[model samples]
Target: AQSVTQPDIHITVSEGASLELRCNYSYGATPYLFWYVQSPGQGLQLLLKYFSGDTLVQGIKGFEAEFKRSQSSFNLRKPSVHWSDAAEYFCAVGVREGFKTIFGAGTRLFVKA
Candidate 1:
């Protein structure tokens, strides 16, 4: 079985500050990884993904992630965040079906100026 755990249920950060979110995964083999962002009452959008290759991958919205095989982790990072960046973030493991995906519970982010 494959699963993801986000230790922080919620986080709050000030505008123009650096941000980092923790993600841990449990899988029998190397699995596809992704990070998605969802605004309040909205659907999720893919931030980034790691399949096979470079450990570090970049994505939209000025975000990046590194796949660490040793730690079994893929953490998301943003050097400086904007107020609009405030939203719910989810780290997910890709499971193969015909064509589908599953997501974590999510971590709500609040931005205070």
Candidate 2:
């Protein structure tokens, strides 16, 4: 079985401040990890992913994540966050070439002006 956990249910950050969202996973094998962002009423958009190779992977909208096998973690980070960056983030884990993907509860980010 595969599962993802996002400990933070909600986070508030000042505009232009650095931001980090924590994600942890449990899987029997090397799993495909992903970070996705969704607006209030919109569909999810892929922020980044890690299948193999480099531990650190870059993503869209100035986002990046590092895959730590030892810790079973894939945390997302941004040097600076904007008000527009506020959204609900979900961490997902899936088997390679498998259709089933398990997503975390999600972390909602609130940015203050």
Candidate 3:
């Protein structure tokens, strides 16, 4: 079965500091990669996704991700982070055929002043 792994259970970054959240996936074939953020009491919001084409993709709210097939990694990065960015991030993999998505354990981001 396909799976996603977020190595960091939680990460702390100062406001305005650069941020990078690691994500690795395991799948037999190329699958869709996604980065979703969920606030304390809100539903998950899609931050970015990589299906094909370009290796690097930009997302909303100053976020981006790079898909490296060789590394099986789809890491999310931001030049600067805000206190509002603090939330739970989940890395997910989806296969088009069955339309099923598998999410990682999730990484909680703490933005310190």
Worst 10 residues of 1 by lDDT: 95-104
In order, how many clashes per candidate?
A: 0, 0, 0
lDDT of every model, 2 decimals: 0.90, 0.95, 0.95
Tell me how far candidate 2 lies from the true structure as C-alpha RMSD in angstroms.
1.1
- Candidate 3 segments whose C-alpha is farther than 4 A from its true place: none
Mind sharing the TM-score for model 2? 0.96
lDDT of 3 at 73: 96
Off by over 4 Å in 2: 96-98
What C-alpha RMSD separates each model from the true structure? 1.3, 1.1, 0.8
**Candidate 1, 34: how far from true, in Å?**
0.4
Least accurate 10 contiguous residues by lDDT in model 2: 93-102
* Candidate 1: C-alpha lDDT: 0.90
For residues 12-79, what per-residue lDDT tens digits would candidate 3 score against the true structure?
A: 99999999999999999988999999998989999998889999999999999999999999999999
